[model samples]
Structure formats: C-alpha cells, structure tokens
Target: MKKIALAFLCFLATDSMAQVSQDSTISAKEEIEIIEKDTLFIDMAKYKLTIPNNWKIKAGCTEEQCTANSPQDTLGGFDTYIESINITVNKLSSSSYTAEKYANFSIGYLPKVVKGFKVLEKKRLNSYSYRVTYTGSKNNIEQTWRQYYHVRSSKVYIITFSAQARKYDHYQPIMEPYLASFKFK
Candidate 1:
C-alpha cells in the first residue's frame, strides 16, 4: 500500500513538471500581458496614488471609501482577491488625537469582523504616525493585511493593503511601494 501511494505521488509530480515545462514555451504571451499592465492615474481627488490601470477601477465606490483590487478579485465586494487595498478617511472630533490612539479605538472591532485575528506587527513611527500588519480568516479565506495610520490634524487616513495569504509575498512587492506615493491634495 505504501509503495502504491509513493508511486502515485511520483506520477503526480512528474505530471506537474511536464505541465510546467510545456507552459514555459508559451510564457512569452503571459509575460507580455503582464508587461502591458499600466498604472497612470495618480489623483484620487483628496489623495494621489499610482496603482495599476486597474486604477481605472471598476467598483461601487463613493467619495469617502474605496476598494481597489487586482483582476483576480471578484467585484461587487472583495470577498475573494489575490490582492486588494482599502482606503478610508475619517474626521475626528478632537484635534489632538494621534494615530496610535485612533487605531486603538477603531481597530478593536477587527477581531469581531475577522474570524481569527492575529497582529503580526504594530509600530508607532512617531507620536502621530503608526502602522500595523495583521492576518486573519474571513469568509473562510486566510488573508494578510498591512495598514498605515496617518494622522493629519484632526483627520486620520487609513491605507490598508490586503492579499490572500498564499499570494501575499508575490503581490506585496509589486503593490506595497505605492503606499508612499499618497500625496494629499
């Protein structure tokens, strides 16, 4: 029985390798499709960002909140996505609030919204700047989230990048740098 299982595994591996070898021959078209991806629109009114031409987004978005995603993501909502980013802007009543305080207050509800929340990293860059990387399961999908908390006077801008846990490493490098491109207008 063990030999049968081993033989089956070896067959599967050989088949997979053959597929990879065959696919490599036509990878140029796939590579061209990827090279064709563009991200030019940088002005989102309140803030500017340079993401993919998917930047010419197709979503149900309002002025205050928006969801951006890669082509692999489903529309109507982001219950499924290989990569996604959510931007939210809010006004605080008190002008003295800091990013750390704001995150503590609002993010308490995350665990309730996410099935298994675990904070990977939380850092306060300064009194007014903070960032957090967390992961959890939601809608039965394991996802990783990286959030930046930017405080400007009484307003706090939250920029969150989320991706499927399995795909996070591959897409994060491509999408994460745009976080620094945000320029308030």
Candidate 2:
C-alpha cells in the first residue's frame, strides 16, 4: 500500500510539471501571434504602397512649396513637423537600384546633416524595387538624431526617431516588421 501511494504521488507531481511546461509554450506562441497582429498594413490596391503606422502623412513637396515650415503643436506635446511622404508613381521606369544605390540616393537628396548611413536590412519586394533601413545622422551636430528609411514601390518612407547613437538597437525591432508589413496591394 505504501509503495502504491508513493508512486501515485510521484505521478501527480510529474503530470503537473508537464502541464506547466505546455502552458508556457502556448503562452509564448500566443505572444508571437499578438505581435504579428500589431503590424501595419498598407492598402496599395490602387497603385501606391500604403503607408503604415507611426508615420505622419503629408503632401510631398519642396520645403519652399510648403506654407507651414514649422512643426505644429499636438495633444501628445510632440510637435509634428511639416514634411511629406512624397509619392511619385510611374516617374521612373523601375527601381532596379541596389540597396547601396538607394542609400546613396537618400544621402544625395536629404539635408547635409545626414552625413551618411549604413544599410541595416533590405527586403526585395519584387524585381524592380526593394525596402531598406539605414542609420543616418541629422547633423551629428548638437545631437546626432537617428533616421531610418523604407523604400517600396517607387515610394520612400523616412523616419527620424531618436537621437541615440545606438540607432540600430533602438530601431531594428520596430523597423524590420514595419518594412516587412508592406505588401503590394
């Protein structure tokens, strides 16, 4: 009787341990699914790549063309800058440019403060175009603000997130999925 009771107690303990382990695995998988759900989706069914979240949309134009050059106050207290997503479709034949080419193109068009950035990740969406992320400077002057760009379907998305020099550590997790979330309608 004593031997049977002892064996039964051992079995119960082992079963409980196994149940806890399974529960942990399920929880982890669920967490991953939730993160995937948070991804931004662009509705580019019309002809343009859809803009994702955390991005402020505006009309693309030269600073001189824009009437409000200053950042506007918002409820969040972080003023929104006057800039544009600046989509130009059918302008170029096809974006056969390499990741380096795109990075060079960015440095060429952006302000001088953007000394030069390195490509962290690049995802080729199709034969013609690619999405890229890089760490550039906003004038490593005063404070070296970090910037990232996501180019897709002839449209470029630029983001100036923070001034941390460890730009990759800060932006990689957020930028990777954001870039991956892009789909051609």
In candidate 1 the C-alpha lDDT for residue 172 amounts to 59
Residue pairs in candidate 2 whose N, alpha carbon or C atoms collide under 3 angstroms: none
Give the whole-model CA lDDT for all candidates, comma-separated.
0.64, 0.37
- Model 1: ten consecutive residues of lowest lDDT: 17-26
lDDT by residue (tens digit), candidate 1, 81-183? 5566777889988999889988887569799998889888898977777888888998898998888888885888888888888766655555655665566
lDDT of 2 by residue, 1-185 (tens): 53453344334333333221112123435544634643222232332222222333333322112111112324235633322223323222356544345545655665444556454555555544555444555534222222334445554444333323443353334333433433444
RMSD of each: 15.5, 18.7
Model 2 lDDT at residue 25: 24
Per-candidate TM equals 0.68, 0.39
Regions of candidate 1 where Cα sits further than 4 Å from its true position: 1-37, 73-82
Off by over 4 Å in 2: 1-32, 47-90, 93-104, 107-113, 116-126, 139-164
